[model samples]
Target chain A: MNIIMSKTITYLQRVEFGDCDPAGIVWFPNFFRWIDAASRHFFIECGVPPWHETEKTTGVIGTPLVDTHARFVKTASYGDVLHVRVHVAEWRDKSFVQRYRIERVNPDKTGDEMTLIMECEEVRIFAARREDGAGIRALPIPAEIRALCS
Target chain B: MNIIMSKTITYLQRVEFGDCDPAGIVWFPNFFRWIDAASRHFFIECGVPPWHETEKTTGVIGTPLVDTHARFVKTASYGDVLHVRVHVAEWRDKSFVQRYRIERVNPDKTGDEMTLIMECEEVRIFAARREDGAGIRALPIPAEIRALCS
Candidate 1:
């Protein structure tokens, strides 16, 4: 079992008007979506995209989160391009834990430094797939993913 | 200035798929969208059709969210239909506060018991509109809405 699969922080931005709330602040849910997207992007860089690209790919199938926790540090507004950093904190034969830090890059937008939106940690399982691809299975992480991420 | 021309309490259901995270639990952000939808629904129930019909009739426009806060308690999972109950917590001159509670309803989905899952508290402000309907205007809340929620 491993506590952390890999640790290479990643970044992204917040665009689109729907990201904001009626109060003009970045709606909290968008933060989670950003974090998830960044983690997926990291995997893509590691050669295993979050979603299986090739049918024979020995990659994650469901990747359902078992638990999620986050803390809000500051406020984010519409049109703010923020930085999303992700790292694998813990890993096991069956599952792994990942964390995220969201910060504000353009102070003029939210008019602040940090503006910590969330410090998030999610525990997820590598959902398994059946031979016929009808139901789910819980399989161990593949060696290539582990090696790349590690 | 008023966001919806009225303050009202709104309610919504927690569907099975609405739980989007792998944790089999409700993700933090989905609650905000539910609250926002319920708020828009509240206006329509109060005779202010929000999306398509009313906005075209009255030159008065809706305000966007500037800030929000939410707290999670117990978890809800598959087949659990949640009840999102909203109330006007504070009705100020330029802005008002809305409080929400996500109750885990019985399997029958009656909401008669209203078993509690979590609660959320958020505040929103209203701005006076510009002549071109593009700029900001600061005005007092309408008397009718205040009377209803006050």
Candidate 2:
């Protein structure tokens, strides 16, 4: 039996003071910023060309998120280092589901125990410039790109 | 027949140069920031005291998001003024749904049309400090607070 497994990549982020809210916890929105970066990094590490380079031939400018669902499991403050594990959970004709698991190392003298901070699943599409040049439209998933990422 | 209506409020935000990403459009995460502010403003405009004030009496510090779903409909850039319409979509025992609709005034000669930029629905809980004071936990929906918001 051939076993097919999705590729996963880990992205690291350090929480900054400015990322916290008045309650001294991560402002929540910053998690989305890191998730976006991790999504890009996952493709880069998987041997996919940068969107700008691919746009020349594929007309794929970038992945634009259409829908997202996120759950905040724990609160994090500044000075915390987070590990974001990203993978493609599902692939459709014109879009894909990118999933992220964000964790923080245990602080209570535990041995490398990782505590989940947040998890997110986003539906995004390869977007191209519209004919009118005013906005963007989704493109079908590129076969070569999908093979590389998968 | 007696009918009860939930209060709705509109919060305005002005996009700044720093809010845009390298793509020259507003970074997606900033939408969450504006949505959060709008969530808070909704309660304030409805006559609910600030979280800090309520913390003393009700032990409710703030509404923390547990889950969220968002859809991006249009792209926005700097100098655009967005209006976020927010209201409580549902009220559960320990959690509630806060909905936001972000829109921008039509830039074309099309008389004051509002273009939908993004929409989000969040499941949030009224949180209070845990007994250990190390974290937060959800509290029952306070009737007075709900009455004020509704």
Candidate 3:
């Protein structure tokens, strides 16, 4: 797999205080949430509008993480400006693979320069429903949207 | 799999308001974290101090979740007294599986009368390590300790 550098995509988010764990570093689990949120945003940026805008949509639903792999390279703390770059590496029959590279953008000494915090890949199954409870299942990527991901 | 109605393992935790998303239910992702913490406690109750007390001895350093299968049986609200129940169902050379059920206990519905809210099962792999990260591999269940899990 060719490593795509940060220059390819434009998804960025500032780490919020809530993202940190008792240890002060961003909890390992929250990274998945941040990247997932950004991936939702990246697609919306690609014209899907399905991520953070989820609650507002009239009948829109969400995609749930089916499989996720992350390797924590560095620690991320509260107040860190995380420059997250995302890309769709593979499009499957009813699911797709989203890759994420999270970096701490603020400069410091050991903490200064942009340090690679984590490299992760997550597979999410999409769903569409509006009700009290729902399950995420694989569905065909609409022709209009599949083209954008391609 | 035979269903087991087990005792509720109460782990007191402060609600991190960030656990909720815009819709207000504890964001689905955080439920997995709570499951993790409770699962660790269950192991400790079985006489396995994750990483074997971290400093005294070393066998497996960490037992992180490798795969998770969860059903959002119900929605859980934020700041609720989450009554979590855990059961060890299967064990393997490198990993073990446990089922978790979480519920919102009501004052009126005390003891076995609490309503069931959510259930999740997470599969975790064990490791042995230290603060600086040092451990070999998952050791076999020590005979003395294995007795408690029964």
Candidate 4:
């Protein structure tokens, strides 16, 4: 069997004061925010059209997260430059797993050392608008979309 | 063995337009944000002092999440009033499990029907400032705090 590996994408951002809590460290929820953004960026970088366009033509509105697990490794603070490495780990019939590794550059360390801030794995589905127009339902993985991402 | 259940606290909030994405549904990370707020509200309702006070008195800074698992059940949109019910599920020596059930009232349905939007279970620890003040370290579960919550 020929196995194709999903492409990896790196998203970069600087931690801001508003992103930190009273403890002077980055608030945990902000990590989820960045991770979500990274997930979207990965798809966009892989040549997938925006969800709005897909919703019109392919009935695919967006990838909605169904399950997630996360682990926090180290603390980060304002002014820190962070990077989120994102990739699709697996593609199932109607769902896929996305993984993220968040890291921060260590200024005091030599030779480009980085500290791991957090890691997360999320299961998401290609969602289509429901007939009642109130919610969404999962759709089977589209071959074209999968080809573009892989 | 006698098992004592922790008291539950409900936090209510209104969804704002900014909390949503272009798809017009509530962004998933906003759920994590609300859950974090509900966790703190649970401690407040249980008579625990704010983290700053605890830091000075007991050296306990705040409860920081180490791990989490979440399942999104339904979609929500702006202007919806959401209720997050939170409680401690288990207490360990250095960490504890906090659970949240997020729901919304459905006016279109009769008899005060509510819709479950998501559920989450988080493992957190009461953290103390490290000696060098650069990061945090887990602390043993405080008896007084546990008693108040239970």
Candidate 5:
């Protein structure tokens, strides 16, 4: 018997004029915005319920980012169609490494070729509402969620 | 003789409702958005012209992020006033380290101090429009820009 250890999910987005800055290219922060959305989408695609639901069932409020590193390889502008591919790179005891690769699809006669725009690796934690309710704290990686994602 | 090597600039922002997530907390990506704005505001406060103007005089378009590391210490919500303090942590030949500290101020008479929401350190480059006009390329630190930021 063979078992798949990890899975990748793709999230699509259309670049809009509002996403660009005065330089006529996508503002860097917009990339992070899409990445965050993609992160959630990955979980959804893996059959995980929304954070609100998980909050009550497992005391997991959400996955809050602990650290991130990103590299912008190319620039994107309005009218571009981007595909954000997300996956869990590693599952730690209390945190996991979420990785993303954003690409711009170029449609041509020779078929579509994807241009690499940016890549990022982030450390995130499944968080539970703090006892005092002031903020959140990291929770141990849930077995059910990890099994679904894997 | 003493020389001031770096200067810090603070940018003020009002947390808007749309900036929050379904959890009623400021979404993480919005932090990056404000940091980007604060980065630009820092240069503007230091007397650097806007990127469009600098693009004409010097081929410099804008500072683009190459690498970044951030930690979220506390969560924020709508109706809060945030102060983002930005400064240069290191000056490289072709890239510089820009640092940011975001704080939520509590102005009650009880003297409760401000809360640190997040902190980030980003490696960015002085970007110039590529000769091929496709994307941007890193440029050596311009003396005038360095002098202003310093």
Candidate 6:
């Protein structure tokens, strides 16, 4: 079987004072915010059209997360710059797996040294307005969009 | 082996305007924030003192999440009232599993009927300041705290 490596995209994020909790560390939920942004950046970088544009043609609203698993590795504080590396780990019939590795860039490093802060994996589906208009429904992976991302 | 059933605690949360995303649904990360608060409320309702008070005697700072897995079942928007039911699912030597079931309260319902919104399971550790004070370290589950919670 031919193995195709998924393209990796890196998104930059800066830890702000409001992102930290009373512990003085970046509150864990903020990591999810950055990861969500990174997920969008990955698709945009891969040349996929914005969801609004795609919606006109395919009725696709957006990719919505259905499940997620995360592990907190190290703590981060305000003033730290984080690099969120993201990619599509796997593709399924109606859903896909997106993975992220967040790292803090250390200025004192001799070169390009960074510390791993957190890691997350999420299952998301391309959603469209439901028939009754009450909610959203998953759509099969779009061939054109998948081709662009893969 | 003997089994002990943990006391279940429910925390109330109201969806705020800022909690919703452009899709008009609760941004997924905000769910984690509510779950975290519910986790703390579980201990408090179970007769455990606040972390600040426990810190003085046991050096236990707080229960910090180490790993978490969550599944989003339904969408929620502002004006929705959520009931977050939380409980300790399992106890380990250094870490414990917390489970949460978030449901949306519907006024039209006859009784306590509610709609399921999300489910989450988290692994957290009782943490204390490390000797070097660089970061937190997991402490053995405090027997007294465990006794109270269980």
lDDT of prediction 4: 0.92
The alpha-carbon lDDT assigned to residue B1 of candidate 1 equals 75
Q: Which lDDT tens digits does candidate 6 get at residues B25-46?
A: 8999999999999999888888
Candidate 1 residue lDDT tens string, B7-101:
44647565666565653455545665677777666655655445343235433355444445555555566567777777677777777777777
Question: What are the models' TM-scores?
Answer: 0.54, 0.92, 0.57, 0.94, 0.90, 0.94
Docking class for model 1 is incorrect
lDDT (tens digit, per residue) of candidate 5 on B1-150: 987557999999999999987666888888998999999999999999999899999888899888888888888888889999999999999999999999998867576678898999999999988888777899999999999888
DockQ, candidate 6, vs. native dimer: 0.79
Q: What TM value does chain A in model 2 reach?
A: 0.95
**Which sections of candidate 2 miss by over 4 Å?**
A109-112, B1-4, B109-112
Error of 5 at B121 (Å): 1.1
For each candidate, report what fraction of the true interface contacts it reproduces: 0.16, 0.77, 0.05, 0.84, 0.66, 0.80
TM-scores of chain A, one for each prediction: 0.80, 0.95, 0.76, 0.94, 0.94, 0.95
Clashing pairs in 6: none
Provide the fnat value for model 5, as a fraction from 0 to 1.
0.66
Q: Is the docking of candidate 5 incorrect, acceptable, medium or high quality?
A: medium
Q: Which stretches of candidate 5 lie over 4 Å from their true place?
A: A1-4, A109-112, B1-4, B109-112
User: lDDT of candidate 3?
Assistant: 0.63
**Tens-digit per-residue lDDT, A33-131, candidate 2:** 999999999999999999889889899888989999999999988888999999999999999999999999776785768989999999999988888
| Residue B19 local lDDT, model 5 | 94
Candidate 4, residues B1-150: lDDT per residue as tens digits?
Answer: 987767999999899999998777998988998999999999999999999999999999889889999999989999899999999999999999999999997867676689899999999999998999878899999999999998
Q: Give the TM-score (0 to 1) of chain B in model 5.
A: 0.95
What is the TM-score (0 to 1) of candidate 4?
0.94
Q: Write one digit per residue (lDDT tens) for candidate 5, span A42-93.
A: 9999999998999889998788888888888888999999999999999999
Give the runs in model 1 whose Cα sits over 4 Å from its true position.
A1-10, A17-28, A35-80, A84-150, B1-10, B49-60, B108-112, B127-139
Report the candidate with higher DockQ, 2 versus 4. 4
lDDT of 2 at A65: 90
For every prediction, compared with the true complex, DockQ reads: 0.14, 0.75, 0.14, 0.81, 0.63, 0.79
Error of 3 at B112 (Å): 12
| Residue pairs with clashing backbones, model 2 | none
* Candidate 6 residue lDDT tens string, A10-111: 999999999987666788888998999999989999998888888889888789899999999998989999999999999999999999999999979587
Give per-residue CA lDDT, model 2, range B32-57, as digits (tens): 98998999999999988998899899
